[model samples]
Target chain A: MMKISMPRWFYQLASPRWFYNFTSKLLPWFGIATLVFLCVGLVWGLVFAPADYQQGNSFRIIYIHVPSSILAQSCYMLMAVAGAIGLIWKMKMAHIIAQACAPIGASIAVMSLATGAIWGKPTWGAWWVWDARLTAMLVLLFLYIGVIALHAAFENKAGADKASAILSLVGLVNIPIIKYSVEWWNTLHQSATFTVTEKPAMPPEMWIPLLIMVLGFYCFFAVILMGRARVELLEREKRSDWVKQLILVNWTQ
Target chain B: MSFFLAALKRELLLVFRHRSDIINPLAFFLMVAVLFPLGVSPDPSFLSEVASGVIWVAALLACLLSVDGIFRSDYQDGSLEQMLISAEPLWMLVTAKVITHWLVSGFFLALISPLVAMMFFLPEPAYPALIISLLLGTPTLSLMGAIGSALTVGLRKGGVLISLLVLPLYIPVLIFGAGTVQAGAMGLPIQGYLALLAAILVFSLMLAPIAIVAALKISIRS
Candidate 1:
């Protein structure tokens, strides 16, 4: 059993050629799935879902806000983990994946902040609040932008990668602080939901769409990341024989 | 211990030798604090109420303003390269630089804050807490700002980029610093607030040296 597993693991999956081939196969499926679920979930959320008695029609923003907020945090974590891998393994591809995650993560963070603020206007009586979670999410956006800017700011790519990786690691320490800041300090922010001890505040009729939208966002993220990474790879590896063979050979075939 | 002291002394000499440059950030701090009261409201009650916040905000900005110069001077002059090649660990040198920077920027901010505190018509009783808060808070600002300066050391237009990079990380310090004065105004025991501010200072102390050193490695790699 160990031998069988080892052979499969030792196969060329870590190679860029294999990874790119694999991602290409996976992209179309994710793209279609993302569109299908996004359309279904949006219709269900905006049309079929019940309006909150308190927030009225504005509650519909939750479908966009929740998924993007979750994605914003997760993308940062994912990119940081990739950066860690790059640091440890000296894997150039891992750094590229981490780099690709920045703009995408920043965009999601912007979406979350925008939707959260829009939702707040109806419920919280203000467009902005210095609440723990909102402020934390805003910081997350800035962190993403910082990493992207640092990446572009350096003339040497390797220098930029290492710098950004370290910065992301530092920012990762703040994630827990951001999560518990409200509880730890006497701040004007709400407590967490979706904990093990309590049922979700919303019914399944509402939560199901949120779950679907999250899935759709994940799929969309995968599609875009692959598209971006492929372009990056083509530019970085233009002189490599495998890339030349893959494109030139495949084009003629 | 001597290494740290020596590094601190060297840094102070370097910064003080350029006394004219040191005053620019201080002036910016004063100007920014004054601008807020002018733009917002002239009402004494209102100015007094927002005075701590206004002062803290300006000090934070001032600290950020001086951050790029922290390592940029040495890095540009190639002293950072020599320091990196030294027998001492780079983290110690980074910490010393940060400490010296805090001494110059944050400590000076504390000393002058009483005078600026008066400009905003801050309550007499609240003066001690305001100065103390800036004193406690500015070291953390220097440490965190070192991380930003380290990250952006070799970049063009690094000053603005450093501010953008550093401001978000500055939020916790701002929150607790402002809380200290706010608590004082409410006649509440400010010890807890000060303790929280101290906790942040300690936390940054433990973490920032490594980050600054790591960022220096990246910055110097190019």
Candidate 2:
């Protein structure tokens, strides 16, 4: 029944140096966890789980499709929040993290689009239908590309960072609009099957593996993002003595 | 409001002084509309059916063509910076400039819309809907475009960059604007789409100036 106060250093962890060191230690753990969970999730979902009565084998794509779609949207939300923090606190670390997240987010979006198309060919009897959900997802992908391009388009890093941050904030208008485009219009796309409160339509056996895949994706995102941030930190803080000392110490170690 | 009027007057004078800038986008709009009939089925009914989409797309392109003009000159002359430091709030000035922008480019696009409608054989009644939709829609374009313009003010070759930034954001306006005309063409109630378009215009009118001011500050600083 005892409680202990955490050290000030715990809160100071927002410092890139602290984060780089902490995340360096955690990266390998997340990488291993990601790999272990990914293998288990893929095998369990693809091999062990029973096929759906309607979709049959094609339903298997859901394991990848749904996870990628979820990550794509969640990554945007993450970047927007990071951008907001960067704007508010003027945190360089937040900006770096936001910049790092864009490509990973865009690739995830592309995968969602590709997987949706693949799943569509079998399920909807068309490769693409211009459905609200599909179109919105496609638009989300474009928004990601737009943010990435805006970031790259400028020579001044600050300009790129701020511009991309604003674009990310503005494009968020589309996310809600996209999510509801189906409901608001009489579109071909079905309503959201995944809800927080209600049980998913798929059984626990299937959903559990899917859940693992989602966790694995998150771990993978962390691993890559940390790697990118470490590189960014070193690059941005290259002139600092601490970086040089850290490099020298690492060499000596 | 007076500032808005003054900015609009200044913008119109600039457009008149450099009239050649107007022709390219208007030509681009015409060419794009012309291509639809060449690319798609030339059947009258089909063209008429999709006329709103064609006109709306062309209008989007035309507006995009002019967005760079909104801030590029001011940025080049450093007037944007001066405005930022002046007693007049930059947002009001930017809003005025955007209003002027719509008055020239968007207004031109609206005037020529009936011709584009004729190309698609749109019925007489749909013509008014086309003008009404653009009247409500084009100001939103200028407002939104002002944000893009402010963002890309200092960049070389900002024309393409501005389009990429603004076009995705233009989707809702396009949807409701075209939906109004489409509804009119289909003999359905156009009230809903028109109301939505008007609401969007109002919303963008309120918010875009502030965003433009922020962007202009950032642009001027860098």
Candidate 3:
């Protein structure tokens, strides 16, 4: 019987020391990319993108709101997948990444909710409505907080990791259901009152900046995730020689 | 099959021995239901309109309250560790515990909800819908809450934490359970809402046991 060798990158990812060192080298590039793209995207979106004929300037909130909302949901998916990997493979680094993700995802969910509310006040004539998409976003925020709280409640790190992994997986199953049910409820009770923004098809001139913003948000998420993951790696691997030596070197320097 | 039955019988015996465990959540449910009429409006029309929502919310809280103890005693007593080491699959054992929990807490809640419903002057036609929805929805609540219980079974602060973890997942059940009764009250076709509740119940039945098993293993390992 032939034993198949795993890929070099796969082994590297499994090692916290390797991930920490690798991410340190890669972090600056992601940071620079995030900064440049965000600046360009915000400028293009705020200054150059044609205003909506109906919503006028208020529609511009979509640049921030949509990207954060998209990132929030995607971040949760990533967190659960990382958690599942950790649980299946017993990879400590995977758990660390999952832990690092919750706070960032939660903050982004908050950003999305706040921006949506701001946009809603101007467009929907209220700061909040029990709209389907908004309600799901709120639930997503609660789910993130639940993961965070469950992780904090455990005294043992490994126990915390496994418990939270199970929770996030369960939550992953509920996300789609929550999304669908909220949408169903919204339509069931939908009043004929005019919605401020109906998200019709947009020309490239308007959508291009929105695309850039979305990409920038992803890059931004990657940068912060790597930064947090690096810190987590250092904390979890603190007892190791490599981490101790690295810390000594930093202190001497 | 015998191992499953034995586990179910053991849990039933344990629950019956501590009768308060079975009765307290029911008492809590009645107290909560009673408070709505006093805290809100006494008008029958207003109470009837809010009846479904109030009952569903209280039932959800009752489920949450009872589920925290589902694995707490076994996990603390080390029997959960023994079960983990046994030859039978953890899924079967965990499912049996969840079933016992539903029988004690959710089943009684469903049986007693109609009496509480009448306090709010719920329309006569909506009574069957309320009872049927609870019957279907409460087990799903117990099953889902079991996952939360299993995860937090080893924790020092398990009670409040279980609610935080489980309540968000409980939203769809709450929506559909209340919707069934509301539809009945308004003279609309309730089959759709009841069918959705049953669909959710079926989905939870199929998937929640697997999650509960995994969660119990994690808690036990911890």
Candidate 4:
């Protein structure tokens, strides 16, 4: 193991045990923040937020759709970056984090798509559109699914991680291209009138809750990502002495 | 330079020896084109309207099917490992491999696409557009699909999984390819779409081999 001399934080971040212990300390705070922000944000957005001038209450789906969509894209970015780190540094922890991201990101993408569909009915008068944003989200879902499928297809965990890491990196490079081409194709053919991607000037009353929801979603994502990564770390490192000691301590307790 | 030529020659020789390796996907491409008429409509007007899209999609899928031809045999017989360990830069070897892939899949498909165009009653002007777009687009498709093939070369049955992994990446190529042909059919300016397709080709040519080499290394290492 030739580790080029690097900063302490880099090595610390590369260690699964360090990550588990550190995240365990932060998890409670993230969990509480997720709970408070989500509850408050949902209540604020659902109740206090002013109804859309045109669509009335139907626009409320934005609280869910926008947050999940934002989270989905960010999750992919994180997964790709983590994968690059894993591939470059041979860091098992980074691989675990990237693997943890695939399913969660896919689920979030599905949520975003579902909420967009639900919102589309009242807003666009249809359940779906080949609009640029919608099509890109669908493609994102497929990319996430591809990463998961690639991971599942491999027999060895290390190979699975490496294979999927390459896929995620490839996908990361393609997302913007896919979004642009889909937009170009949409405008060329569909003559779409109402673009959901446009953020019209919303009053603070409308946007504040949306902002809170976005924050809540990020916190919630972190809470889940950390928990998932920690569990994956435990499983991958189960053969290690520290993990065995930790497991025995927990069992005795 | 010589390494690339040698690699290309080897691949060309191999593909020539196993002729079905070249014929199967072309037959599959023709079959897919046939399905558009049978499955959709034989009406000339409707078929003409969709002809570009139908041909481009069929070409994309055909290229995808042949992508395994890029690395599968090599992986199976362990030449992939040998290549990985070789002193020659992996990219040059894979680039030769990809060029050979495009020759069999993209080049021949473009050469024969006019026939598919005529069958679908595509207008005369669009034949050039269809051929050019397929010519430009399918190389990118082959390059991109090679990455998927390299990644999945380790898997036993990577068939549908390869489609799942590669098709999204193919969308830009598909859009520009079909759109260019559609533009030609409508007598609209196709230069813009053709330019975009070429840009995508250049972009993927620069990057896809790097990804393919990396993916092949991953598959081989694992």
Candidate 5:
């Protein structure tokens, strides 16, 4: 029988301790990047970007709304992928990442909903509508809440991880169907409401800040995820020597 | 094949022995449909306008109500552990359970939906579409709901949690199911909606058992 050897980094990455150390080094960079990009993007988008011809400055909400929505969706994909990795490889660290992702993703989904509603009141003359995108986001919120609740219901940690993994994977399958159906329903209803993505093309000034905001949101997600994952790792590993020593060191410092 | 047949028979026997387990969801379906007319309007025109949606929503809830028990008793009685440890493929056993569940819950819901539809004053032309859509749509509901039931079978308060996990997944089915009857009511061809519902049914039928098996393993293991 041949023994297959994996790369050293693969094993190291699987270790929660190694992940904690590696992310600690990377966290400062992500935090700085997130701050810089968000500050620049907000200033450029709010004060400098060209206004919409039809909606005027009300469209500025897109800077926060679109990026958070994108983050909300991507965060779910990331969480599910982490869950799959955990299930297939039996990696505790991966499960930790998946667990940490649920609350952050849920909060981001809420932010998207809030910003969307605020934007809606000014532009669409109503605080709410069954517009396809909005309805889809609302469903996305429900999906997030479901995953979070399922995770919380279990007293056993491993069971919670596997259960939520199955759920998020199930949710992953539904997300595309939800997206397409909402779009189809929108067309059937012919609401003709203004959609952020409807414009054929935006000039550089408009899209440039939008691009910056999107990047900033991704960086922000990384910072929060790493921070939460580290906390989870510590809690799970509290009785371990490394965590104890780390705590003692911090206390001494 | 014999093992599968025996498992199916066992499930059916258990379900038939508890007659109210079979009747409760159907009664819920009828009662919910009754509520719609009183809550909305008593006018035939108004009830007809919302008839397909009212029936579909009621059916969806009833299916959800019944699915939590699909694996709960088996888990509680230790039969699930026995089945899991057996040499038989778990998915095969899960498919059998899911089939029995649909027969009792989804199929019965579809069969009685016409009576419930009458409460909402659904039009004559829409009756066939409603029945067909429920027939096609409810199996997918049972299949999807089985996964939720399997996941939460070991939990103490799994009923509400099962709804939370399953309802969002139920949206596509509801959309197509209601759309079929609505299209039929509007005198439009409903083949597209029916086809979509059947597609979903087939898709869930093929894939959902595998998820159910995995979730059952996790739930039972812990």
Candidate 6:
């Protein structure tokens, strides 16, 4: 196989030591951004954002619900891409990132499903419905749990990483088909479907805060992923001198 | 192609040596389908309504029952590692293996589905639809299940874990397979549902062997 030349920084990013140093420097900024954005976005969306005429106050849960939903899917995409990169380059750093992604993505998926259920109560008049989107999200949660379980089942770290990576990438391809099929199934069984939740168009007042919430969620995700990856990198690379040095310095200080 | 057939024949011979590998899933399929009626109302009208879904779900589980065994015997016996390192392309061998899995599991499930459907009081019009949908849909199930089987073949409790990995991926096929039969039951056109099942079959056929090959390497190396 021909090797494609990659830029110097690509290799740098793949190195665990370089990644630890770089993220250590960048983590604080991401943390601060996460805090600021989340606080502002939550306050604005939950407090100031105009409510849906049909559902009134209960509709406000969309502030958290929509962001968590979007981020949950994005997290899967990130996990799969990171897995792909790790497999292609055999990069420990990439696998760490992918490993770090599973729990966070799974938790975020839970948050979305929970929030959606909360919103569903007042909106759909039920706690759960086999709606297309909800069913797809439920399957997404199962996919995440599978990845996390597979990763844990492997006694070997390398095997765990590669196996879960392959699974997640396979999931990446199936998700759309799953989503589309669920949507089709929903249409076929249209009795339980609700048209009430469909808003004509979001007023800028409503969507602007949503945009902010989405941004906040993305920042929060980046902060958490980097934080987890940093810890994983250290744990996996503890025998390396730089990790040992960093631990020694941190412990002493 | 000859190599592929030889590899497939080897897998079939191995399964035949332990014949339960062929009968267990079919028996499980029969029992599971029976449990649905016992758990739910066995009233003909009610059973007829849910029969399509019941059969599809049961067949899916039966396939899962056997799929983990696809690589388990080979992994335990040391043949999987040899195949992985063999000069022959691994994906071809994997495809052959998955096909045998389908032969033992999916193909037989399709054959017996109408018997279960009759027990569920499935409409006479839907009989052909049930068989065709299962025929088209089961290979996809086998392919998708192979990825999970390959991933977990080395684990002591690979069977349950295979379900956790494979069942979620099986949803589309289940939906379409049941939909085809339900459409036929309702005297609606079955073409659309069959097409969807065939589409999923094609998609999985193209991609799943690649994932299986990758997963088998990961499992073997670990």
* Residue pairs in collision within model 1: none
Winner on lDDT between 3 and 4 is 4
Give the alpha carbon lDDT tens digit for every residue of B42-76 in model 2.
99999998899999999998888878887887778
For all predicted structures, in order, the TM-scores are 0.92, 0.93, 0.95, 0.96, 0.96, 0.95
Candidate whose DockQ is highest: 6
Docking class of predicted structure 5: high
Model 3 CA deviation exceeding 4 Å by range:
A1-6, A187-200
What's the DockQ for every one of the candidates? 0.49, 0.50, 0.87, 0.92, 0.85, 0.94
lDDT tens digits by residue: candidate 6, B49-153: 999999999999998888877888789989889988999999999998988899899998899898999999999999999999999999999999889989998
Question: What interface Cα RMSD is found for model 4?
Answer: 0.7
What is the lDDT for B114 in model 5?
A: 82
Error of 2 at B120 (Å): 0.8
Q: How many pairs of residues collide in each model? A: 0, 0, 0, 0, 0, 0
Q: Please give the lDDT score for candidate 6.
A: 0.89
For candidate 1, lDDT tens digit of each residue in A152-243?
A: 88888899888889888878876675445533444565555346598888888888887889889999999988888788877788899999
Chain B TM-score for all candidates, comma-separated = 0.96, 0.94, 0.98, 0.97, 0.98, 0.97
Work out candidate 4's RMSD over C-alphas: 2.8
Worst 10 residues of 1 chain B by lDDT: B181-190
Task: Choose 1 or 4, whichever is better by lDDT.
Answer: 4
Every candidate's lDDT: 0.84, 0.84, 0.89, 0.90, 0.89, 0.89
The reply for model 5, stretches above 4 Å from the true place, is: A1-8, A187-200
> Per-residue CA lDDT of candidate 2, range A74-178, in tens?
999989888877876687888898999899999999999999899999999999997878878878888888898888888988878887888788777556744
State in Å the error of residue B9, model 6. 2.2
Please give the distance, in angstroms, between residue A224's alpha carbon in candidate 1 and its true position after superposition: 1.8
Given candidate 3, what's the lDDT at residue A152? 98
